[model samples]
Target: MIGRLNHVAIAVPDLDAACAQYASALGATVGAPQDEPDHGVTVVFIDLPNTKIEFLYPLGDDSPIKGFLEKNPSGGIHHICYEVDDIVAAREKLLAEGARVLGNGEPKIGAHGKPVLFLHPKDFNGCLIELEQV
Candidate 1:
């Protein structure tokens, strides 16, 4: 089962501009940009009191984020991550419930260095959901 809200991920065409807006206009604390080649994204985290906002940009032409940006030129909320106590158990439960898991149905190392899995957007009311083990 899902736990606390981990972070909301937003795909942005321009990573630096997005980070600058959050840091200056919103007066938020933006973390350093990190390249997650495995995930094909360059990300920056905006720290918040309760949760975090993740800014995602395409790392290469083949990056999934690039396709997302192509569909949404202005960029938008890419996914919402929720914490899980045990990813394997959670995956099994969701699978048994008929929910579709994305990408080979296996957990991958996320931006936080935690095991993460992505669920099909249609399965979760048109919003991509990420489950991260905490």
Candidate 2:
């Protein structure tokens, strides 16, 4: 049902600072910031050999990341994304298994320009799971 790890997302209060820290600390190529208005986050991806690390900042006052930041203050991991061959089929299988899907249970276009769906954190042992069709 899940393929390779896609990316790990970290919610940050300051996107620039996070990106700079990653760039200097990891010495990795950090991509430009991309504003995803639909998701209400401004993100930047730090490329790694095996996977990517996404730094997300709230885009608006109502952004979900804003709430996450409020809770964690310093910010922390928000979600982990996994690649799926077919998101619809994956969603069906997950639903049949009684897993709770977040939002409308429909796939939305994600920052990577792929269909993505988020699963409830409690269902995955307190870790938010994002399924991205690759």
Candidate 3:
């Protein structure tokens, strides 16, 4: 099962501009950009009182974000991440309940360095869902 809302991920064509918009215009605290080669993204986290906003940009030609940006040049919300107490157990429960897990049904190291798995968007009302073990 899902726990607290971890973070909302947004794909942005320009990382610096997006960070500036959040930092200067919105007066938010933006964390340093981190390159996640495995995920093919360069990310910047906007810290908030309750939850975080993740700004992601494509890292390579084959980056998924690149495809997303191509579809929507302005960029948009890519996914929402929710915390889970146990990823393996959660995966099992989801599978048993007829939910489709993305990527071979295995957890990968996320941006937070935690085990993470992505679920099919169609299974979650057209919004991509990411489950991260906390």
Candidate 4:
């Protein structure tokens, strides 16, 4: 079952600028960079009260975030990540219910070094879904 709302993932054109904006606006302290090569993003986490916020930018031309930014010039919220206790079971349940998986069958290391997977937006009312196991 999904646990807490882990963090909200936001795709930004410039990670540093976004981090600064959140810090100034919400008094959030920016954490160190987290490189998720499997997801093709390098992000910084901003600590928040109930949940954290992630600022994501492509690390290279081939990153998915690069394509996302190209499609969304101004950048936007990429996905809402919900924390799960068992990612394997949650993935199976999602698939069983006909949800499309964004990534391969294997769970990849994600931001904060947790196992994570993304569900396709087409199956989620155009809202990208991220399931993270902590």
Question: Candidates' TM-scores?
Answer: 0.95, 0.95, 0.97, 0.88
Model 4's alpha-carbon lDDT is 0.85
Error of 3 at 84 (Å): 0.2
Question: lDDT per residue, candidate 2, 1-134, as tens digits?
Answer: 79999999999878888888888986889999999888888999888999999999999777889888989999999999999999999999999999999989999998888999999999999999999999
- Which structure among the candidates has the greatest TM-score? 3
Model 1 whole-model lDDT (C-alpha atoms): 0.93
- Give the Cα lDDT of each candidate: 0.93, 0.92, 0.94, 0.85
Residue 24 accuracy (lDDT) in model 1: 96
Superposed Cα deviation of residue 124, candidate 2 (Å): 0.5
Q: Candidate 4 residues 1-134, lDDT tens each?
A: 88999988889988777877877887778987888776688989888878988888898668988978999988999899999999999999988999888757678877667898989988888999888998
Off by over 4 Å in 3: none
Clashing residue pairs for model 4 = none
- Report the lDDT tens digits of candidate 1 across residue range 1-134: 67899999999989989998999999999999999888789999999999999999999768989988999999999999999999999999999999999999989988788999999999999999999999
- Model 3 RMSD, rounded to 1 decimal: 0.8
TM-score of 4: 0.88
- What's model 1's TM-score? 0.95
